[model samples]
Target: MEIKVSLIISVFNGEKYLRECLDSVIRQTLKEIEVICLNDGSTDKSKEILAEYSKDSRFKIINQENIGLGASRNKGMELAKGEYIAFLDADDWLVDNALETAYNEAKNKNTDITMFQMINYKENTGEEKKNDWFNLDKFDKRFKDTVFNYQQTKEFLFHLSVSACQKIYKRSYLERINAKFPEGIYFEDAPFFFNIWLRANRISIIKEYLYYRRSHENSITAKCDEKFFDVIPSGEEFFKIFVETGNYEIYKEELINFAINAYRLTLNSITEDAVEEFYKRSKRQFKKIVNSPYIEDFKKYMSKGNQDTFNNVLNSKDYEEFKKLNVNSKGNF
Candidate 1:
């Protein structure tokens, strides 16, 4: 039997880039694939485009209220009938033969998760220009002996930021761990990928750059809002889970570095309403981190940028220091 893959996408106000994204998927060299587009209450032509695409046999559209990316993904999971699952952002796309290459390799190797490289393209770029934006150098020898563990995976993530688009996962593994993207949240890919990496065994890697990620201005990562701070609580939840289950002392440094960097990012993006709440929550969280029994290990990864942010949080009174922090400023670092 031929292997089947489901390409799931969640969209909101994606009319501008919807067609291009869909076109890339339809043109993939991987023939036995299904395209499931979840319309999460887009107030634009996004729904119209989905309707138009529904005419294709492989296209399936689900209209849903604005339940956020997590819920949309979970809904897609429920509707998907494929053995292997792949995620794609509405604004991003895959290169030709991307899925065909990854799928064949993963199946042949009998691996649980398979990953590749991605190229980020700008909006105005033409087809040829878009393909040239990424660094395509392959890294075969370096990662050859790297074994998979929760700690090794965490360290690797420090270098390669967790992106949902760069990998294809098995549906059985996702189901085994009950790994659904959390509903009503931003940066929702965090807990999901963290869980997947730790759970996956027999993983395979491809050095090819197969995914094209578009860094659009209106993308979710571009919105530095109050909801951004929610990442702290969500991250804390992941840390606790990892520690309790793995008993791995190795993630301390990376965890601290991740937390500190995230703190700076959150503080720098705060609005008036987000300032007081962010200060209180983050201050408490940082204190917990610094006072933890493993403080010394955590300090090993204390980046200069994190230390500055922490000091600012400690010395300031009632959002004053936070107000002094740059919000969308140039060369603030």
Candidate 2:
């Protein structure tokens, strides 16, 4: 039997790169797939370009008001009619064999999700950097590793921060848990990863680079803002479940590594709320790692800027001191 996959690509005024993204999808080596494009109120030629592709049976378009990327993805998930689901951003393109590789891996492992590596590209200079999406070095792929339950998967959940566009998921798993992207948040992928890993029975990792993440001017990931840090609330809520369940005790090391990477990313963005929120979470989790027991190896990778912020939060009497100075903050944490 042929495997059918629904590829959800959410667009919001992505006129500049929409054609190239669609071309990449339509040229996928795995031809048994449908491209579901959700136009989230694009006030550009994105809608016109998408309309042209609606003529193809393999392509479907849903025109809706500006509901944000998360809601647009949820809307696509609702209408998806495939056994497997893959998410692609309108501004990014994928490798030709990505879908075939991910789907085959999931089937062979009997896993709920399969993730692969990605390539990050600079839109202006055309410079490229490869990203190991899962840090699969932790797993022995030569053998069949049986992850009995969701808790076993949390060991790998932190890696989901790498990127959502790199993975393909089983529709039944998502349907069983009613999984959908959270609406109106910048980091919609974060909560989805947390919740899915909590419910997913098995996850397989593919180390080969398959997704290309284009860093363009208007891309949300390329831009920074206060509202972007709105994801902290959801992060806190998800982390609470992680700590309470303690299903991830074995992966504390990975969690700290994840936190450090997250900490650095937030700091580099120079957003006050992102900085403050990371400070708060790291402070709360400090006791857990104070003894250098779980994540000693990652200490070297910590940036001077991050270390400074961490120290400031640890020693400073007031959080408002730095917030008052950030141009983006205008006095808020």
Q: lDDT of each prediction vs. the true structure?
A: 0.75, 0.70
Q: For each of the candidates, give the backbone clash count.
A: 0, 0
* Candidate 2 per-residue lDDT over residues 1-333, each given as its tens digit: 353789999899899999999988877898888889999998999999998888878899888899998888888888888889999998889888888888878777877877677778889989996544434444455424443455554444564443668788899989998887778777777767766777676776777777888987777766665554544554545555456556445554555445555544564574654556655654555445455444453354445444444444454444465443332332222
Q: How close is candidate 1 to the true structure, as a TM-score?
A: 0.84
Who wins the lDDT comparison?
A: 1
TM-score of each: 0.84, 0.75
lDDT of 1 by residue, 175-277 (tens): 8888877677677777777767766766767777788888767876766777777888778766765676573466667777776787777766767677678
Q: Which ten residues in a row have the lowest lDDT in candidate 2?
A: 324-333
Report the Cα lDDT for residue 104, model 1. 80
> For model 1, where is the 10-residue window of minimal lDDT?
130-139
